[model samples]
Target chain A: MRAAAQVFDEYGLAGSSISKIMTRAGTTQGAMYFHFKSKENLARAVINEQAADLSLPERPEGLAQLIGLTFFLAREMQSNVLFRAGVTLAVEQGQVGLRDFSPYDMWADLFRGELEAARSKGELQDDVDVAEVAQLLVAAYTGSQVMSNLLTGPDRADLPERIGRMWRYVLPGIAQPDRLAELREVAERTGPAA
Target chain B: MRAAAQVFDEYGLAGSSISKIMTRAGTTQGAMYFHFKSKENLARAVINEQAADLSLPERPEGLAQLIGLTFFLAREMQSNVLFRAGVTLAVEQGQVGLRDFSPYDMWADLFRGELEAARSKGELQDDVDVAEVAQLLVAAYTGSQVMSNLLTGPDRADLPERIGRMWRYVLPGIAQPDRLAELREVAERTGPAA
Candidate 1:
């Protein structure tokens, strides 16, 4: 999987091939297929695997943390080209061309769960329009990776901070006015979204 | 040039060699070189050529139109996979990454220009952040395209309405309370988010 991540980092999801995956993994096609059914299936497993690493506790903090956590998780995954390429390519396919739910539907499910949970906890606006907010955040963060990765290449120092700022900056507009106050309270308690 | 667009679309930026371009354009490399100095210059010219066809007015009402124009141009160039390829390659090479500045940038530039003009016209709040707002719009709209494109594939219908609703829904937040009246007045006279 790490090898797969490396290959994806170099060529991208739309650009990856089974042969390359096999060669880089130091395994044969049969060995690779034994663990995963198809290319798309393998890609999905890799994506969900990373999502697993990104999951957080049900108990939460301010709106910024909730939002920033999501963005940070995404930026962190940027280092894993496997996950990054999968989500980005999925985003490009799903948002621009058609309703691509094949792989992303699962990611969206997890994301939606987190978002709705936040809303119910008063971490989000009551009328926050969960669907639209999720859509925008996903787009912004994903687009950020695309733009920044392409323009600045993949350097992490600026990414998490920039990603955090993007969430902080945009969250105010989408969340209830009081949510900002909640963010400060939470940040003071925990250093994450600070 | 249209033939060149077709060739680049089919083969992608790096994939399409000079021989392929000449073959598709039905001209020898000699004739092609006469017009474009190098592959980069030729790619640059193709960008300019394709850009003119996708250009839109710099009006606020035209923002959504501009967004729509880019998606349409991209879709038209969809079969031409090289649409963002050369541009990304250029950016990777430390250029503006504006190689032929995808219609998206023009949309962003137009959004910035009209927004600043609106601010100048006192149609916006003096405290309003023009660049941030513009960046937000660019991120959202372009982000939507990325999401729909990479995730779902080629969804066009949902795009226009989605973007329209997006621009309309967010306009109020970016405008000052005093300018709210002008915005409503403008939106009614021109269009939502005008």
Candidate 2:
């Protein structure tokens, strides 16, 4: 999966080949095929197992958790080839003959859970729809990483800073008025690169 | 340029070749090479000339102009191959030998101009930094397009809607308190698919 993700990330779908993945993995065709069946199948496995390396910090639940999760993702995307590969594959899936929105959907669902908890804790404004905010966060984070990746390529050192900047612009619209100051504080303290 | 953008958009940078672009353009390799020198040069030209097709609407200045421009971009990316190609090439620059952040920087500069105008007109909150907000918009828009392109593929039918959704979550934080209601109204009326 890691090798497939790396190949897919580096070359995109149409440019990647089974031989390249095998060489990257240092495995024989028969052995690789035995596990993944085909190139597309290997790609699928990579996409499906993308989140295996992600682990959010043991922070308090609610908005802080969401903030920490975003920061963690930015950091991971910088250092973790598998995570970055999964994102690249998920974004470029159409070129690879795969129809999948599950990656974004799964992320939205995860954000929703965190937002729902925040709502229950009165961290979110009454009018702020958890699902909508979740989608917004996913979209913003996804785009930020893509831009950072494009600008800096493999280093990805600027990703955390970009995402940290994102939360600053977005969090104000969703957090409760009274809780706004604290939430902004949380965002700043946990901000990208911090 | 059109042919190169289309090929790049469909296959990404690594997957694209001079012959493919020439075939798409209905031109000969010698003719293409005479002008472009190499595939990388052609790709660079495509990235550099991306904004040629773009024309912002003659609308009122300030935040409304910014909003309209975002909507306009979504519409263009849906219909304009050159614009899409430029964006694709810029985002996937890692595959090509060229290193360019000019595309994004240009976008940020454009957004900053509108934001500066908005601030001058008192449409923005005093606490807002035009540069920071501009970067945020560029990042959010970049991310939104990637996700929309991912979920909907080349059709990109849902792009305007996704961007509209993004505005809903982002604008309140930047608009002046007195102008918030009007900004929200404009967002809904100009919203994607609306």
Candidate 3:
């Protein structure tokens, strides 16, 4: 799985081949076939397990936790190859004709849960729709990472800062007026410093 | 060019072959080679000319015009195959190891210019940074379309509405309080019926 992730990361799904991955993994074809039937299956496994390495320390659930989650992802994207490869494959999956949207759906649900908690605690505005905002956050985060990859390189060095800027622009529209300043401060802080 | 756009759109850069493009174009290899020496060159042409067909009618330059431009793009992404093809290739270019960022840079600059105009007209708050907002807009718009494509499909039927939602969430962070309601109304409206 790790070797496949590396190959998929560097060459993308369409550009990656079983032979290349097998060579990189130093495994025989028969053994590789025994474990995974096809390249697509390997790719899917990588996509499904993308969040395995994304460990966030325990924190209160609400808008601040949501902000912290995004920050953690931004930092992970820079440092974790397997996680980064999964993201790269997800974005490039269309090229290989793979349309599995489970990752996106899973993320939206996770964010919606966070937003719902925020609303329950009076951190969110009364009229804010948690589901729609959750979907939008997923989309915005996806695009921000892609743009960072293109403009800043594969390392995505500026993603954390970019996400911070995103929160500053988005928080005012959803969060309660009283929580705005503190939430914006939370959004601006980089890494797991909290 | 149209045939190449269609082929690139469906197959992406890596999966697309010179022979497939030649067959799609219904032209001799010599003729195709005469215009574009390589597949990379053809892909570059498509990327560079992605916005050639994005025509916006006469509108006052400010926040409204910026909003109008995004709407126009959303509508185009639905009906215009060539335009959609260009966008698909741009997003999928990294799969083929092509990292040309001129398309993204062009978009950021174009958005930044509109934002500068908006700031000058007092449509934006005094503390807002036009350049950062402009880049964020580009990133958000890019992500929104990708998510729409993934969740909604290639036609992107919901993109205009989604972009409208984005503006609603973002405007409050930068726009003057007096302009919020009017801009939010403008953002919610679909199509080019101004």
Candidate 4:
């Protein structure tokens, strides 16, 4: 999967060949074919795996952990060269083919659940449209990273700071200030990087 | 230029060969090459032409026009297949080769100029970070259109409504309430679709 992702990222999906991926995997064609029937199937598996890597489980106990995870994922997304390669493949796809948007649906569902928990706990504005807010935030966060990719290219120097600012602006609007203060305190106490 | 744009729109940049564009324009290679050296040059020319079409003048009078233009462009971007062609080319180029981002820079400059005018005219907040606001709005507007392009493949049924709602929400915070009310009246009078 990593080998395929690397090839797919270096050259776009259309440009990458199955033979090239097989060679990179250091495996025979039979082995590769046994795993994934076609080139597209292999590509789909790479995408599904990358999505799984980023996906987090249900967390009702800690909003801070949720925020920290998003921050970590963003950092990893910008730093990990393999992930960047996967991103290139995804961008090349550009929503051109593949009918299954189940990953997006799943992430959205998970995100909505998180926001709903916050609302139920009285940690957000009573009037806050949780779903809309969650949707907009997701859009802004993901879309901004794409922007970062375009502007910064392979050297994503400004990503961390930009994401830092995003969280600062976004968390203030959504988080209950007192609870957020405690979370910040915890993060600070944990470490400098945290 | 329009012919070239049409060619690119109907068939993607790579697909729309120079010969095809020349055929569309009813001109020979010599004439086309006299103005543009290659297909890339022609694509640059078409992009430049779009920039010229969107020139807001060194001095623009209408505050509402500035905001309206953005809203209008966002909707146009979503609905028009031709618009997607440009986005696709730009994004694709960014991933592989360095895209001719000069056109985007030109548009950003024009957008910033209008924002400065609005600020000086006391239409926008004096403390408003015009650079941030301009880029933020452009990024969100462009980014959302990209998302819609991905999700819906340019059918664009809810695009105007979505952008309109986003505009209504953000514009109020930036624009004076009286100005917003005035614009609201004008919008109602025109009875334009969202």
Docking class of 4: acceptable
In order, the interface RMSDs are 6.0, 2.5, 1.5, 4.0
DockQ of each: 0.26, 0.49, 0.70, 0.26
Per-residue lDDT of model 3, residues B84-149, tens digit only: 888777887776567877888888888888888898898998888988898888888888888778
Q: What is the lDDT for B19 in model 1?
A: 74
Taking all chains together, each candidate's TM-score versus the true structure is 0.70, 0.91, 0.94, 0.76
lDDT of 2 by residue, A1-194 (tens): 88888887777666789999999999998899789877778777888788888884443378989988888888888778788888877765554567788988988988898888888898887888888788778888877777777677765888888877777778778888788788788888888537
Best by TM-score: 3
lDDT of 4 by residue, B30-81 (tens): 8988988777776666655554444345565445666666666655565454
Candidate 3 residue B154 Cα shift, in angstroms, is 1.3
Give DockQ: model 1: 0.26
**lDDT, model 1, position A95:** 15
Number of the top-ranking candidate, with lDDT as the measure:
3
Model 4 stretches with alpha carbons more than 4 Å out: A35-39, A55-57, A60-69, A94-103, A165-194, B11-16, B19-23, B26-49, B55-66, B78-83, B121-128, B168-192
Model 3 ranges off by over 4 Å: A56-60, A191-194, B57-60, B191-194
lDDT of 3: 0.83
Name the best candidate (by DockQ). 3
Q: Candidate 1's residue-wise lDDT over A1-194, tens digit each? A: 65665665566554667788888888987788888766566555555554544446465443545555665564566565556655544443211122345454554554566677777676665556666666666666555555555445654334454454454445555566766667645433433343
Could you give candidate 3's per-residue lDDT for residues A91-132 as a string of tens digits? Answer: 777765778778888888888888988988999988788888
lDDT of 4 at B12: 57
